[model samples]
Structures are given as structure tokens and as C-alpha cells.
Target: MRTLAAFFLCVCALPLWAQEDAGALAREAGAQLEAASVRLAEAESARNRVRALTDTVHAYEAGLSAMRAGLRRAAIREAQLRAQLQARDAEIAQLVAVLQTLTPDEAPTAFLHPDGPNGTARAGMLLAELTPALNQRAAQLRKDLSDVESLRLLQEQAAAQLQTGLTEVQTARSALNQAMAERTDLPQRFSEDPVRTAILIASAETLDAFSSGLASIVEGDVGWTPPEVDDLIGEFPMPARGVILRRAGEPDAAGIARPGILLATRPGTLVSAPTAATLRYVGPLLDFGTVTILEPRPGTLIVLAGMAVSYGKTGQIIAASTPLGLMGGLPASNGPSTGGEGGGAERSETLYIEVRENNVPMDPLEWFSTEQDG
Candidate 1:
């Protein structure tokens, strides 16, 4: 009987020991899975960072190229103006010499003698003939002087532009270097699906279509949660600081109804992201100078147009208030002009800001600060 009881106890204990072993194995597997998930997230973050840096480097390069081109053009214009000015100066000198020769001397001469009436009459006729010629030369000198002044003004403007371009180029180069240094070794997000990308690129008819296709692909992930616009309302800042020249629904200079607000800013004004966003596109579009489109959240897009230079690349994530690029040349003078801060020289440029929801245009004024509405 004692032997039988001992056997029964050992058998019952075997099942409990087996259950404990199974539980321990399950816990170990769960811990390993959790660690893998963490590592994958870390890898994705690093990849995004490398991609952003690469895009920034590319943007700086593009900006530098544009600035170099502008500098070359300005140099050419300056040379032409200098040549014209030299020619005008030569013509003026010749006119002065002719005038000096035509003028009568202060001392008495044979023609000035009144002893013979023929001599005096001849002198009077000579004087009359010379009067018209003197007047003509005077008028020509005045016109030439005006042309010189105009040319001088142009040269001054060109010089200023050249200097600005040089400074910008240097700044962009530094930024490029920094970005390159910060870049990490990680695969780019876009390269993950080359086959689909190649197909889209081949099929897209226009840049707009291409951008739309890319946006769709980017937003296709089922886990993404778009931020509510209401939550961001009044919380975001303007991409650039300037006076509002035209509000949405108002007629623009071309007499077309504008879907965005046009802000009059100074040239080379730094443009930044109004909110945390992912860049969708950055390049020239038809009629709209260099443009940059950003998506702050899924289904919402913000468009910044009329920039002279654009920085940052497509698909790069940008934090709020991060520098995008500088505003390009001044816009057409048809837009309203407002004084800037500190009584500085008034320089005006038009920046078009548009916000779209699900690709439908919406008034950006509703989203911007009320204090900036003026």
C-alpha cells in the first residue's frame, strides 16, 4: 500500500512540472518578440533620419545651382551696362568739345569790330547760326546724362543682387556639408518599392499627377492616423512672415479668383514650415514659380508658391518652424504693398499660401492666426 501511494504522488507531480515548463517557454518567446518590435521601430526611425538628411542635401544643391545661374546673368547684365555707359561718356565728351569750339571768345576779335557794318552783320549771322547748334548740343548732353543715371542705377541694383547671391551660395554650401555629415547609413523609404515607383513614374502624365500618386503610396499604410485639422487650428504659424496682400476668394493681379492668401514679403525672406509636415513636392510648376507642397497630416496638403529657391526634398519630414527656403524675387507690383518692421526699406514679394483637404481647395485664412489677417 505504501509503495502504491508514493507512485501516485510522483505521477501527479509530473503534469504540474510540465505545465510550469510550458509557461516559461511562452514568456521567453513573448519577450523576444517585443524586443524585435522595438528594434524594427528603431531601424525605421534611423532610416527616416537618413532620408531627411539626404533630401536636405539635395535641396541645398539645387538652391546653390539657382543662385549661381542668377549670379552669372547679373554679371552679364553689369558688363553690358558698363559698356553702354562708356559709350555715352565718349559721346558727351565729344559734344562738349564741339560746344567749346562753337562759343565766341571773351576777348575782342576781327569779327567783333563795329568799324565795318559788313563785319558786324556777318558776326550777328554767325552768332545766330551757332545758337541752334549750341542748343542742340545742350539737349543731347542732358539726354545722355539721363541715360547715364539710369544705367548707374541698374548697375547698383545688379551689384547688390550679385553680392546677395554670393552670400546665399556660401550659406547653402555650409548647410549641404552639415547635412551630408549628419547623414547615416540606412536605406531610403522610396527605394523599398522601386517596381511600383517606376510604374508610377512612367504612367503619370503631369507633375501634379506624379505627386498625387506618390502621396497615395505614402499614405497607403493602414496604421497611419491623420491628425485632426481642428486640433491644429490656430495652433500653427505662418510659413513666412509678411503682410497679407490678398485673401482667399479675392481677385489676384491676373483677375482670377485666388484660392489662397498672398503675402507681400521682402526678397530672401526665410520661409519655414508652418507645422510639422512631410514634403510632397519641391520644384517649378507651370506658371507658379518654384513651389513646395507639404502634408501636415494624411489627406491635408499645404502649398507654398512663388519661391525663388526651394530647400528640402520630397518625402522628408520637417518639424514646425524649420527653414524651408528663401522667398524668390519680388512679385509683380500689382499686389498691395505694406511696410515691414523697423522702418526698413520697403521690399515686396508675393507668396501664395494654399491649404487643401482631400485635394479640395480651402481658405487658408481660416487656419491662420487672426492677428495676421491684416
Candidate 2:
């Protein structure tokens, strides 16, 4: 009877042991799942950070390129001014020689000369003949002097601009180095369909066509979803701080109605995102220079063109206030009204901002902060 009781006790203990083992296994699985989730979150954060840094580096590079171009232009202008000054000097010297030769060395007196009337009459005739020439030469000299002064002023300005550009390039390079140092290893969220992307890039002739192709790909992808950006409109800041040089609907130099607002910004000025957005395209687009296109929401796109350099790859999501790129150069207030001469130190940069809804252009003023409206 005791042996039978022992067997029954062992049988009951077996089930209890199995149950404890199962619970332990379940706990282990739960712990692993939690750990994986944490790792994923960390990876996502790292990726975003790297993306932001990449964009900043691109912008700085663009700014540096612009500065260098400006420097080259300033140097050219300086050479031209020097040549003009040399020519003006020669002309002035010739005019002075003629004036000196025409003028009398001493005053004539009737008491000191026997042929006084004849001499006086000849003197008067000579003076009359030279009067018009003297006046013309004097006027020409005055105009030349003014021009020389203007040229001198322009040279000083150009020198200052060149120095500023050098400084900006140094600062941008340092910042770029720092950004690179902060980079972390992170897995990409989506695998790039190289074949499809290459085909699209090759076939698309215009920016609009390229944009359409990208939109189709984004929509077809099941893993990606457009972020809700409408709620953040007007709550964000402008990409860069600068004066509005031109507004939407204004006629540009090409006589085409501008679909965007152009901001005259300082050279190497920092540019950031106004709101959370997904980068769609970043590259050169015809006469627009280096362009960056972002999708803040589905069916809505924001275009930033006229950059010297661009950052970030396609499909990367960026947070608000993230650095995108820097402005290329300063705008020339004294230059022609048309977008200032390109690649010159005297010329300033214009950041073109355009907002599109369903591929149709819209005024960007309504979306920017009140501070930017002016």
C-alpha cells in the first residue's frame, strides 16, 4: 500500500514540473521579443540621425561650392576694374596735356607790349577756340573720377566678399566633419529597387515626370505610409531666414510666371525642414540647379531648388527642424532686378520654395509662419 502511494505522488509531481518548464519557456520568449523591439527602435533613431547628418553635409558642400564660385567671379571683376582704371588713367593724362598746352603761362598787359591789341586779339581768339574743348575735357574728367571712385568701392566690396566666402567654407567643412563623426551604423528601412530606380531616372525627362514616377512607386509600396503633415502647417518655421526677393505669380526673368517664392539668403545660411517630411528626390534639375523635393503628405510636395548641394536619399523620413542644406550665396541688391548674375561674388543666392497640391502649384506664403510672410 505504501509503494502504491509513492507512485501516485511521482505521477502528480511530473505534471507540475512540466507546467513550470512551459512557463519558463514562455517567459524567455517574451523577454526576447521585448529586447528585439527595443533594438528596432534604437536602429530607427540612428537611421534618422544619420540621414539628417547626410543632408547637412550635402548642404554645406553646396554652400562651399557657391562661395568658391563667387570668389572666382569677384576675382574676374577685380581684373576688369583694374583694366578700366588703367585706360581711364591714360585718357586723363592725355586730356591734362592738351589743357596745359592750351593755357597761357603769364597774363598780358597793354603797357608791357607794343603789339598789345594784336596780341590780345590773338589771345582772345585762341582762348575762345579752346573754351569749348576745356569745358568738354572738364566734364569728361569729372565723370571719369566718379567712375574711378565707384570702381574702387566695388573692389573693396569684392575683397570683403571673398574673405567672407573663405571663412564660410572653413566653417562648413568643420561642421561637415563633426556631422560625419556623429554617424552611427543603422540598417536601411527599405531596400532600394535599383533596377526600377535606374529606369525611372533614365526615362524621366522633366522634374514633374520624375516626381510622378516616384509617387507611383511610393503609393504601390505596402510598407510605407504618408505621414500626416497637414496638422503641422503654419505651426512650423521657414526653412531658412532671409528676405523675400520675389513672390509667387511674379514674372521672373524668363517671362514665365513664378510658381514659387524666392528668398534672398545669406551665403552658407542653414536650411531646415519646416515640418516632418519624406525625401522624394535630391539632385540637379535643369536650370533649377541642385533641387530637393519632399513629400510632407500624400498628394502634397514641397520643392526647394537653387541649392549648391543637396543631402539625404530618396524615401528617407525627416523630422521638423532637421538641417537640409545651406544657401549658396548672398543676393546683390545693386545688381539687375533679374536673379542676380550667376556664379559671381556680387550676386546673391535665391532660395526658391514651391508648394504643390495634387501636382498643382500653390502659394507657399499661406503655409509658412507669420514671421516669414513679410
lDDT of 2 by residue, 8-78 (tens): 34433422111111122223333333343343334334645445443433343344344344434444544
C-alpha lDDT of candidate 1 relative to the true structure: 0.55
TM-score of each: 0.43, 0.48
Which model scores highest in lDDT? 2
Candidate 2 accuracy as lDDT: 0.57
Q: Which candidate number would show the highest TM-score if scored against the true structure? A: 2
Model 1 spans > 4 angstroms off: 1-229, 330-345, 370-374
Off by over 4 Å in 2: 1-173, 177-191, 216-228, 330-347, 370-374
> How many Å off is the CA of 265 in candidate 1?
0.5
| Residues 240-271 of candidate 1: C-alpha lDDT, one tens digit per residue | 65678888999967898768889887554657
lDDT of each: 0.55, 0.57
> What's model 1's lDDT at 317?
64
